[model samples]
Target: TISYDCDTYGNPIEAYYAETFTPKVALYDGDTFIKYIDSNFVVWEDLRRIDYSYGLNLKTAGCNRKPDNNWDSLAKILNPLTYWTNVYSKDCYSGAYSLSSSESSLPFPIMNSSNVNGLSWRGSEDGHYFFTLLVIDPDFSYCTLKTQFSVSITGVPLLVSTQFLIVLSTTLAFILVLAATYFFHPSKRKIKPL
Candidate 1:
C-alpha cells in the first residue's frame, strides 16, 4: 500500500467492515483511488530492499530471475502485493514464476472484475492459498503490522509430465478402437468380460 492510494480519512477503499469483515487490495488509476477486490486478497508492502539487512527486505526486481537469492524470495518476488494486479505464469517447477498486477492475471481481467475493478483468479492455481500482509504505520514510529493476516488466494496444482499425457491418449485410443470394431466389424463378435 502507498500514501496516494489511501482514502481521504486513511482507510483503503478495499477495507470492508460490513456484512463480512475483510481487507482488500486497492487499485489506482491516475489520481483516483478505487476499491478493488476478489476471492484472493493480497497485501503488498514495498520495502524495496532499501532497508535490506537480515530478512525484512522487500525487493521488486523479481525472484526467479536471480539464482543467488533463496527460494522464498525467488518464489514470492511479485506475490501478495502485486499478484492481484495481473495474471502470472503458473510455472513453479523451474522456480521461474512471475505475475503482473497491472494486467489481468486471469484470462479476462475486466470480465471477472469486482465493484472496484480488479482481476480475480477462480482457483487458477488449483490449491487454496492464504496470504499474509505486513503493514507498517507512517511517521517511521511504532507499528501494529507485526501480525499477519490470512487471504483468500487459491493454490496451483502440481506439474505433470508429457509421458502421462501419452499414456492417457493411448488408453483412450485403444478403447475407442475396440468400440469401433465391435460396432462396425462385419462379424459383430461379442466377447464376455472377465
Candidate 2:
C-alpha cells in the first residue's frame, strides 16, 4: 500500500501505472475518499508506476512595445520535470498578428528554444494580445499541457502643441459665434444714403 498526501504546494496530482497488473487506487479529497480498481485481472512480469503534479502560473510586465528578455521569469512551471516546447502569440481582436517558431514567422525576434527566453511585440497598433505556451514531459509522450496568458500594449500618446490647441479653440469659438448670430439674432434693415 502506497500513501500520498495531496496538500503539497496546492498542485494537481496525477498517477500512472503499467497495465500489466490490476491495482486498487484510492483518491482522498478532504474527508471524502473514493476507491477504484481495474476490472481486468491480468499479471505481467514488468510493471511501472509514476506520480506527478502539474500546474502553470504566468505574469507579464507593464504594457510597452519592447522585447522582454525575462520570459522565463514571467512564467512558472509547477512541475519541474516538464519543459516548454513552443510559445505562440496572436492579437486578441483580429488575430492578424501572430508569432511562433514552428510557423517561422515573427514580427520581432524572440528566443525560441525549450524554454521561453524572450518575447517582443512590434505591432503597428496598441491592443491586447494572447500567448499560448505548450509544455511537455519528455518521459511521457502523451503528457502535454497548454497554458495561455494575455498582454496589453499601450502606445505613446499623440502630442499636440499648445499653439495648435489655442488656434483650434479660437477658430471653433469664432465659428460658434457666427452660427449663433446667423440663426438666433434678428436681421436688421439698413437705409441707403442718397
Candidate 3:
C-alpha cells in the first residue's frame, strides 16, 4: 500500500499511494526545508505513517532544548527543515519489529540506530527524538527490501525480547529432556549368557 524512498542522508524522497499512479507525497530535505510531506495519498500515505510518526515530534535537549513550551513550539525549537534529518541519522534499531535474512521478509542489514541530535519540548520534560534506521538488502525471497526510518521520543531504546524467549525455551526443553533421559532408560537389560 505505502511505499517510501530515502536518500543516503536519511531524508524521505518520494512516497507513493497504491490507488493512484503518481506519488502523492514528496519530501524535500534541503537546508531550507527539512520535511515536506503530502498527506493526500490514500493507502500509501497510511503505510508511510508507520515510519512518519517517528519524526513527527521527537524532542531532545542541550542544543535545541526549549522549555516553557508545548509541542506547538516543537517546530521553532527544532528545525523542522532538518528535524526528520536528525531522526534518520541514528545507528540503533528499536522498532524494526521484524529484521531477518529470510527471503519471505525484507533483508535489512542495519538493524536499529539512534541519533544524539535531538530536540526538546514541554519545558524539556520530554527528551529529543530518537531515530532508528533500517537497511534492507531488497533481494530476499518473497519480500521487497527497502530502506526505512523510524522516529520516536529520545531515550526510548528498542527492546528486543523475542530472541531471548526463543533461547530460554530451547534451554528449558533441553533441560527437561536431560532430566527425562536420566530417570527413564530406553535400553532393555541384557540377559546373562550361561
* lDDT, candidate 1, at 42: 27
Candidate 1 segments exceeding 4 Å error = 1-125, 140-158, 162-194
List runs of model 2 lying over 4 Å from the truth.
1-117, 136-142, 159-194
Candidate 1 local lDDT, 9-118, one digit each (tens): 24332311112223454444567976553332223324322111111111232223322223244335645433332233232225645433531122211111232332
Candidate 3 lDDT, 81-194, residue by residue in tens: 233222322323344333222321221112112322211222212122223322222222123222233222233332358668888899999999999998897768788999
Candidate 2, residue 37: Cα displacement in angstroms equals 34
Number of the top-ranking candidate, with lDDT as the measure = 1
Range of the 10 consecutive residues with the lowest summed lDDT in candidate 1: 49-58
* lDDT, residue 52, candidate 3: 25
What's the lDDT for candidate 1?
0.34
Query: Candidate 2 lDDT (Cα, whole model)?
Result: 0.32
User: Is candidate 2 or 3 superior in TM-score?
Assistant: 2
Q: Which stretches of candidate 3 lie over 4 Å from their true place?
A: 1-3, 6-164, 179-185, 191-194
C-alpha root-mean-square deviation, each candidate: 16.9, 21.3, 18.9
lDDT of each: 0.34, 0.32, 0.31
For all predicted structures, in order, the TM-scores are: 0.26, 0.25, 0.24
**Candidate 2, after superposition: displacement of residue 185 in Å?**
14
